[model samples]
Target: MALPWFVKRYPDLNFPVSFPPELLSHIIRDVCYNHDPRHPAFRRACCRMTLVSRAWQAVANSTPSLWRYLLVEYSTSQLHLAAFLRNSGEAPLFLCFRANAPIAADPDMVRQSLLESAVYISHTIRRWVAIDVELKDASVFHSVLLYLASLPSPPLRVLRLACAVPRHADRRSSFAYGFHGPTLRQLALDGAPPWSSPSPPTVALTRLSLHQCSWPNYSDFFEFVSLTSALRHLSIGTVRFAGTLPATVVHLPSLDHVDLLFGSNVDSIPVVASLFSRLTYPALLEVAISFNGYGSVSEFLRTPLAFRASSARLSGICSIDEDFADVYHRLFGVVTLDLSHGQRAMVSALSAEKSHALPLPSLSTLLLYMPNWRSLLDVISSRNDGQLAPLHLRCNYPEHLAVTHHLPHIADHDLESHHRVLSLVSSFSWIHPM
Candidate 1:
């Protein structure tokens, strides 16, 4: 034989005659050394290199792990999509749908394709971390979810769905059965629903988030949460507590954390008072709430449950934000407190006309987001000179939050969290007749 000719073309470089499968990767890497994969040229190089030789082909086919990401625009056709998956190595796929267009799918074909993929995927794909679907309407969700339901997806860990409007009661039932993932964990749904009613309950999920959802009423909303027996972290954008939160709700021996976002808008504080008053989940370690509407944190703080929690967050609470030194003094043991975003405007509106304030003494972690560093220093300092302590500060971009860096008061923590969380309230004095 002619000794495998690629050597003759690059004679100056003196290519190796043969290589172990791993060395083949080094050769491919060198060929595209200066090329950026993010650029079109980089992808083209990959395509061209795959066709180079039989040995290279084996390496290309075996490295399917490189294709762990998936992205699909709204216009992507479902029928063609299955074919794409079949031909593409077993990489996870991500699809973003159109706001107006529904998901196009052939149910039978989708289920069949999933089964076929599983035959090969069980040994090949280690993790299916995320699924992001953005739709124009809820109706589109039905088609995609149905097709997915018929298929097997036990490897999923993160599930996210975003839409302009929320799914109606009828559409929500699609998740009631057929699909199950004991290993499944994070779940987030956005936008408001079209019709409001009690939807299917969810269980086995560790973290749950609902943003701008439409519920039929208070009772219906509670009924929906009755499903999450396994939920550990609960974050809501709107918490409408018009009804009961299940007599069995507090017994969630596994539930220890709670996040209430803008709950005061829908009578949530009163309900929270009622719930904690009636049921006591002693294991509860963290509680995060943005008391933005009405009601004071006094009621919640005075509860019997206070002794059980190690950390808590209350956003927009008048008692906390008004520069009240006493409030900060009461929460001395708090390890991390985030007063960054929600009520900065409220502070500015009232601060311009106030007297000098005292600095906080017990704080170790303080986050500031306002343009006024002077005010921030006053709040964290005991002196007025505006010098800060060694406390960690997370603000604008140069250093965003890494996992270990987040000082998420109480709302974001899971029951499994042991990190010490603490917060300090800003102290306020009268305008002194300015």
Candidate 2:
């Protein structure tokens, strides 16, 4: 057979001949993580890469790092499990296992399959850097947690456990494992109580998210919070406290972001307010709060619960709640105010307040989702001294047109009709919808 001159010169050719094995391995890792539509899952991408050729197969098999993150499925065979572990070597692993069966599948079969897989992986808990276990059946969760608890404290960086199914009181004993490892940085517990073990000696945790947890009392939650001195982000979703928060305040020097979502009609305002007053964030930046029942957050916004954060976004604070605008009078340094979820009547009330004219001295960017653009414009005009940053109007096209159309019409009394407010309005450029 005759061949081209270049082909004859090289003789041995590769499909992707230009890239070395290391470079090819790197490219494969990138592609797997990119999670392209063609290869939506990392395992799927890895499987496809292995079929490319002997060269690729060798590369994939030798790349221990590539097999570290595993999403164990019921269909995964023992051979496949062994191969993944063998290839992963000593690299830290991230595992996500859910012992949930499909509608068509038998529950017993699914449980048995998960038990087999869990038994195999439990021995390698030392290598687990992060793990997420979600189970709808409490029996299945208890079985899994029993094996997990038997292991020594894992070198876990992040751990998320969600057991949505109800279980007997005795079932909680299975998850009495302690996570006092120095590297534990993030902890998220759903339908799980705060662990009874001693707190980590190192306060290295930077993020904590508690979702529907059953804490014994406010003291327990506060005690847990006190341990995480290095916490920067905290999210509490529908967590009800049975007892009043302690009079002692917990200062988090590094905290900057907080998200609080209270359950509807739970009367959590006292708990939330006490928690707010307790914590002092000198460097706090952003806070978002959503309360189900509305007496307005005005009471919480008063002095003891004041936010030093430059940005605040409150949801469910109705218009009729007077003194809402009065709260901002203390936040003289707040540069951005997000009232997108604020009521139209509240915006009007804010605009009409005589004290609103000089309340927020540093407020430059005002974000609103109200239909009353004129009222907001009036509020902006009322500001005594501050650089008018662009008004971020998150509204429909009609509202946008109306705002732009009416910006020029300033009342004789508004901003003294000196054209200063109009000039400020002229500087505004419609921001793309966020």
Candidate 3:
């Protein structure tokens, strides 16, 4: 085989006629630092590189960035853990501790290991830029919380806590305390853990997600949102807000996306509406809402004036209770429209308009959920204008099999119609017998 141009030009640079040491060093550094820390591929690649040779092993061990993310478990040795942290040098650290792990077959050993790991991690808490912890027992979690309470605000940017204890666990009070990270921007809490202190300073978070987290009262929840002045994205799932929403509007100047979901509560719609009414987020661009409460979606829809007037986009609206007015149709400019589960009467209402104002001009995807073949054909026939952008039609009923027979002849089988038409027929059974 012929030598490459670089190898030929600099004979001394070639090490065993392959990768130069300088190039190899750069590649290894990039692989370890740039790859996603959570991906298994990262660990697999690093492990493979270490087996290459003693030179590669030395390089991997000396690279401070490679050991920055540590998973301290019961099986992890204190000596090895200390060496890993020391090798990480001054690089910002990401630490994860699972306090519920059992050590060997002994429960006493497990407790001792948990205590030892928490104490060791606390000593290095100032080096942590992000922390994720999982604690199941109330007593162990309370002890860990004390160490976390003493954490001095360093470069901590993300904190995620998952407590698997029961809702009535005594340690819940300790979990309610706030972290003291001056740079914390993202916080996620799951399984009923209170993530903030009693008097949390105004932290300008950009993203906040809460799943099944309980607050002391409605005021506390509102106060938390108010303090996050730089918040841009917020997600709430199955989190209940008690008492009436504050009348005062809280403005989030940078907010761009909001997602609210509800699983239980008869007053979900009103509660969601009340929350929306209290916020003024002029920069919002996308919104998603799911509620199984009393009243139709229209009630919640009417609450957010910003959603309608602002240039907000949605994935798709998928509820069909009653036909909404044309004004609602005019407000939406979504690229993908899923009206399959929506009321069929909406098509009639839209077709009856004399203006034919092209309500969904931006629409590129349309789904039809019809009772029979003829209804689907009727709706498709009503849209005679070929000026529409290319469309993808998805049919949800088996009876609409007849559609394929006549689809080729639609619009007189014109070239423009063929180019504009795209059909996606469902092979599965999502349609029920009416």
Candidate 4:
């Protein structure tokens, strides 16, 4: 057999004349695995690897892991899908089915293609370890759901399903019943029903992310949370809620990270406040809350549960009063605080003169987005006393540059000492424009 194309093309260059089949297989797997099967480059690379040499072809064909990831798209040929299924052997599969219609393609053709691929893949459902299905057509989405519902449960670890169709147009039934994967660890749903399953695969789930989903009432949501006792990280974005919440609080002992983002709905204030009041996660390490609505930070801070999170982010808060600051100081052991869309009132509250006790005493890192330097300097100066730890400030590019330029001109020796305590980090790209 001839050497690889690279070695043959560059004959003068020193190349290994022979490689242990195991070593060669590892090399090929690493190269192929780097690109997801959905990417055209992955298929091209796999084809080129087989064409490299007779030995390479044998190794590539024999390694079932190399052919385990199957991307089934509307444009994908049945022959290619069959080849992947055959080559994968008994290895666990990572299947991604994208039923999005190609540009200018007939809708009927797209649906037919998706149906065909779905049928082809259904035979090997038990071998699937992870399944990601993205469908744009409502009919196709429903069809796929029904097909999955009829199939026996797979040992799926990760399940991500996204539907682009509008909610109103889509049927209002629980799609969760279609999926029954007891081993599922991570589940992400976008524009899909959250939980309708009488027995969901929630017990094993560690991470759950819901975007643009609505709960019929708070009880369903709480019940869903109750089932997912092992959940460690929960993220809900722009979720719509209805009905009143129960007075009782739900305890999640294992939860460590909670992220909530409410869109431009003023009604979400009550939902946000209710979550803060209802959920108790003692081991929580990080909490991020953002809402584009007319809600006070004080209302949300009225929860009885005190979070020991070292890091906290509060965005879209236009003002923070001393009361809010006091509550915040009591609620969280926040070592790092991000106030991206903060106002002057918030800065004042952080630097408020408190003779008895300082607010946010544990705060060591402060991240702001394009904050007024004068107000920020005041914060640094006010907290510079021996009582609290020195502040580490991070700001956007323009503000950092401006501060660096003006720092030398400030002639006050005490202020210079304050500046010395600050470790100013200019996270240029990370801090986006408000």
RMSD list, candidates in order: 15.2, 14.6, 15.0, 13.7
| lDDT leaderboard ranking | 4, 2, 3, 1
TM-score comparison, 2 vs 4, better candidate: 4
Model 4 gets an lDDT of 0.47
Candidate no. 4 TM-score: 0.58
* Winner by lDDT: 4
Model 1: per-residue lDDT, tens digit, 253-310?
Answer: 3445766655435455565565556554646767776665555555556555444566
lDDT of 3 by residue, 1-434 (tens): 23323234444431322222222211222233445444665555545452213334443466545544443333434333333343444422444443333223333443345434434433444433243345544344334444343434332332433334344533323332222222222221111112233333223245665545454556656655555455666765555665766667776555666665554554656766776677776666666554423244455456674254333322224443344333345444443344543435445534454424544444444556555436545654445444433445555555444554544323322121234333553211111112
Query: Clash number for model 4?
Result: 0
Count residue pairs with overlapping backbones in model 2.
0
CA deviation > 4 Å runs, candidate 3: 1-59, 62-65, 73-126, 134-152, 162-206, 211-215, 226-230, 262-264, 291-295, 305-323, 330-336, 339-378, 384-434
For 248-279, candidate 2 gives per-residue lDDT tens digits of: 87665466776665555355556567667777
Regions of candidate 2 where Cα sits further than 4 Å from its true position: 1-37, 40-68, 73-126, 135-154, 163-206, 210-214, 226-230, 247-253, 280-282, 303-305, 308-310, 335-337, 351-364, 370-375, 378-434
**What is the per-residue lDDT of model 4 for residues 1-434, given as tens digits with 9 covering 90 to 100?**
22323223444433223322222121222234344345565555545453213434443465544544433333434323333344444422344444333222234544345444444444434333344445554344445444444443332332444445355533432221212222221121111122233333412345665555566788766765555445677776666778987888777646677676666565665666666577776677777776544456656656442354556667766666556645666655554455666656556665555422445455555765654756765445433333433345665544353454433322221112243343364211111112
| Candidate 4: residue 132 Cα off by (Å) | 1.5
True-structure lDDT of candidate 3:
0.43
Measured on C-alpha atoms, candidate 2 has an lDDT of 0.44
TM per model?
Answer: 0.47, 0.56, 0.52, 0.58
Worst 10 residues of 4 by lDDT: 425-434
